[model samples]
Target: MKNKYYLLICLLLSSILGGCDARWDQVLRVKKVQPIEKIDLQGIGAEQMLPVQFPGKSALLIASKNKGVLLLDSNGDHLVSAPGRVETLAIQSLSQGSLLVAAYDELSAEVKLYKLKGGIDRKPVLQYLGGRDEISPQSALCFYQNNDRTHLFTIGDDGLGHEYLVSPGPSTWELVEIRPLYFGEQVNACAVAPFNEKLLFSQPPIGIISMNADAEKDEERKLLMQADQLGEDFGGLWIDHSGNYLWLTADARLQGYELKNLQEGSDQTIYIDSNYYPASVGVIGKNIVVLDEEVDSLLYFEYEPLNPPEHPDLQLVDEFIPRIPASAQTQPVSSAGDAADDPAIWVNRLHPEQSLILGTDKKYGLNIYGLSGQLVQQFAVGRVNNVDISEIQHPTYSAIAAASNRSTPGIDLFAIEKSGKVEYLGLQKLNMKDPYGLCLYYMDSRLSVWVSDKEGELHQLDIHLGQDARNWQLKHVSRLPVEGQVEGCVVDAQNGQLFYGEEDRGIWKLDLHRYSAGMGKPKLVAEVNTKSLVADVEGLALYLHEDSGYLVASSQGNNSYALFSRSGTEFIGNFRVDMNRELGIDASSETDGLAVTGANLGTEFPMGLLVVQDGRNRMPSGRQNFKLVSWQKIENILNLSSATAN
Candidate 1:
């Protein structure tokens, strides 16, 4: 009985530990660190402090009860001021030496915007641009940029967050729109790190929040802090200029983390050995300033230079185009944890409006959906990951669909009947360990199915059509070894050519006849480069028109698709499938398998449809599902309406 009670106690403790961040160790990298230097505020008590950037200089902006807005240099020497006691301040640098400043005052319940212009010998001028009355004092205020849009993010003590679109033209500045973040309790601290532009917030003793500050990308928040150790006083957030380090202040502890290596469980933790209840931390050129909560004076410590600044993932906004909205989405998979893997679109020739989409539930079975994205049928067969379909001139079947069945360790075939319904045919066994991605190709009287395995093996088989349905069988035709794991495969049946992704490597081209012959090897048409593809390239599909088309690959690392010309495999462009708020459909992320056809399927999909498996189904968050996009929407956005012309 004693042992049983002890086991229960151990289980309870483990469960609590699992919800918190990793264990904290003694101060690593920086040792014997404490605030040795003190900044004599000279009887000025500061309520808040932040490091602000000017045209050619930077200074610490402090809010004092006596002084309105005090700008102090590294030596704590006062530079300038915007009079009238301010509680919070948020500023972002604009083009042409104009600083868009946002200030809020608690006494008068006023929030104002000013255009700050500074010169070497002149007092920084704050040109009043706009003002608004607030109901209550906001907890924190910050600015963030997403693409060309700028927004102001603020959190209140009510645990509610407000995001407002801030438009600062040459002459005017005002909040144009508002987007709300309804976070329940304990969310107070918020800071936008400069280098990565990641929005970091702390929920006191709860956890640390890290998410994309950009309104354009996935705003999914991630926790990266050891909450149990952070105490309830963990709130203040600061980012050093020209660095990627995120400085955090909690009660008697102060630590900075290089977020890039933090996820890798690296010990880039910079800490202070001594205790200090800091109200705010100001990171300057060569010193760190912390406002002492108990005293009128400020404390300063000499710190080592922070991590150098690198480009942010938000840089994709400039490098890659914005995601077009998804037109429709299918019901989520019944099973969870990466169940919905790939999708194959079946265009009904008899009834063009009655097209169907066959998607794989790698954890359960297969799901069939109509053009409206409603599940028409579901088959609890086995784990089928990736799928494709091809028109076949068989004696019995009208069209054939095939998927890589990890359960069978081979290919699972299906028949697309004229009623726009899918029927399970049979599974062809493969000797490979884990058969992963599969695509079908049919020309003349020959129908071929290609399957790739995780252990770097590629195989091809020919299906022999029998008059009876049960007599259908597969004959192994070719087997070839690859360099690395491959998942996405596509075949251009019109040209008798094959294209496949080598996962981490790049996309390759091979002649269909050279599968087993080893006479001539596949040519690396496109190497996995930063400009075109980011690795573990998951999906590949061809949008063929006449004799030329485009090869689309799921650049899963960045949640975008890279397009290449089919004739020469030249990198055309990259695009993302963004969210459609009106239709209530979320964007695609970590896309596993996608299928596209350039054939118009009636008025609903007049330019055909592009179906992609949305690995992270969010917006109205649910299980994983497939997002259907209009092919014409992609072509127009990429300006390929004429580019795909023969």
Candidate 2:
């Protein structure tokens, strides 16, 4: 009986231990994965735009067309709604739990202020009117605090901006000062930040305006790095926590200015290319949040308060070929081969060396090529003009095309396999006047696709697809009106700068951040002298060698490319392309499309390859074919061959 009892005890112990062992096994096999939660806010229609988080809170203020403010928490939960039919609204909260909302009526030409009890959506307890009770609030309103006191400022349509103090005692306020903001021209938006006893206000499209609380006398704002002089638009502005460093986003670049001495302006201005058009700017923690509305994505960078922030100075180390080769040429296997035009190369970020070259041919439809320049696959997409590819979190790839038919007049998105197989995704009818160039960039932490109309307008689109690619949503972000006619656009991935090329004019740079401010204008970097280089400059590329300090720009008409020193605005030599004798050379004219071949040619080919359009002018047949030539041969023509010849 005792032996039997011992056996039974052992069995029970084994069962308990076994269960524990199984639990341990399960724990070991468990994988910790981050959960993605998406909160949807309804009632907010397409007209409500520019939803921004309120500083130091979980609430967000949205611009609405319904003439009211839509308030919500950070988690997309609706809090309350403030009703007003004001043309424009600006919100700012003070340390004393008081919120100020500035509303402007363009049609009525009046500026009204509403002091809310709770927040932006709370009921208004006080109101103030500006400008003859008839003048509209034509300028952007900004809020600033000095010594526990808050001030509200605005620029009028007459180019004059005024400041008022909100006395905290009751609901009473005082018109402290009314100063004229002279920007040499018209002012679009004004921003003010506290600097000791005085305030720093920026009247965009001109310079920085400074004023003190005590109006002993008024002084004209000094030109702190003139916007027009820099040849770019004022994109966005931000003041650091310590109020020592001022960040400005100019066309195709971001600049850091030291505010140590207000009288001396910024001690140093460091410029960086943002690889995309920076439309707006906000602060998230210590990172500078830049919004590129063109691509509908947000870029984050660590903010440095030093006189000159330490940044990557990408220079052209060598003009040699990259080790990677272009994807193999693809042939149309589909029946709709006669409808494609331009082919764009999309490199996989996860696999830098791996890329997909997509082309559009009228007869072949859309063709995909491998990195080796070999045809991988082909499919029909009606008639395609341009193609773009984007990588998402999922394991799938999304391809977009600007196509047209008898009924449709815009671009569409398609689902593509990593292996180059194409499937019809969805069509986006932009109803644009003339859509030509299509580019994609990540903005606001989302993938945004930009389609440019040759008439100088850009349409920002958001592409969303339901499960199984059944439906897609394409929402327009903003329609930007450009100055000169734009032909092609390239984003500087290293710095977030956007380079826009024109046909007769040179390249224009847009500080995506500043553009988002809805103020200022685009600055011209290098004006194209049609009489010298190329009559019509179109394509642009920044070739940064691993350790070198040079950048090269290719011009199609001059049949040559120019090199510039990376540090300053000095011209190096120019390299001519001898396409007159090449196979696909057309005597009529050279056109757009330029790319650098990423392959090492040890002996014969040497410094990679330069690809361009071989103007053949044949209409269905005149669509120029792309030509590839060795960069080494071109360098020899530029008079640098003997110096670096191996």
Best by lDDT: 1
Please write out the lDDT profile of model 1 over residues 204-302, one tens digit for every residue.
666787887754346777887767767667767776554456677776656666656555542223344445567788667666778775675678776
Q: What is the TM-score of each predicted model, taking all chains together?
A: 0.66, 0.40
Residues 15-123, model 2: lDDT tens digits: 3222112222221221111112223434343122223343344344443435355555545555566554443455566456656766564545555555544544443
lDDT value, residue 283 of candidate 1: 69
Alpha-carbon local distance difference test for all models: 0.74, 0.49
What is the TM-score of candidate 2? 0.40
Best by TM-score: 1
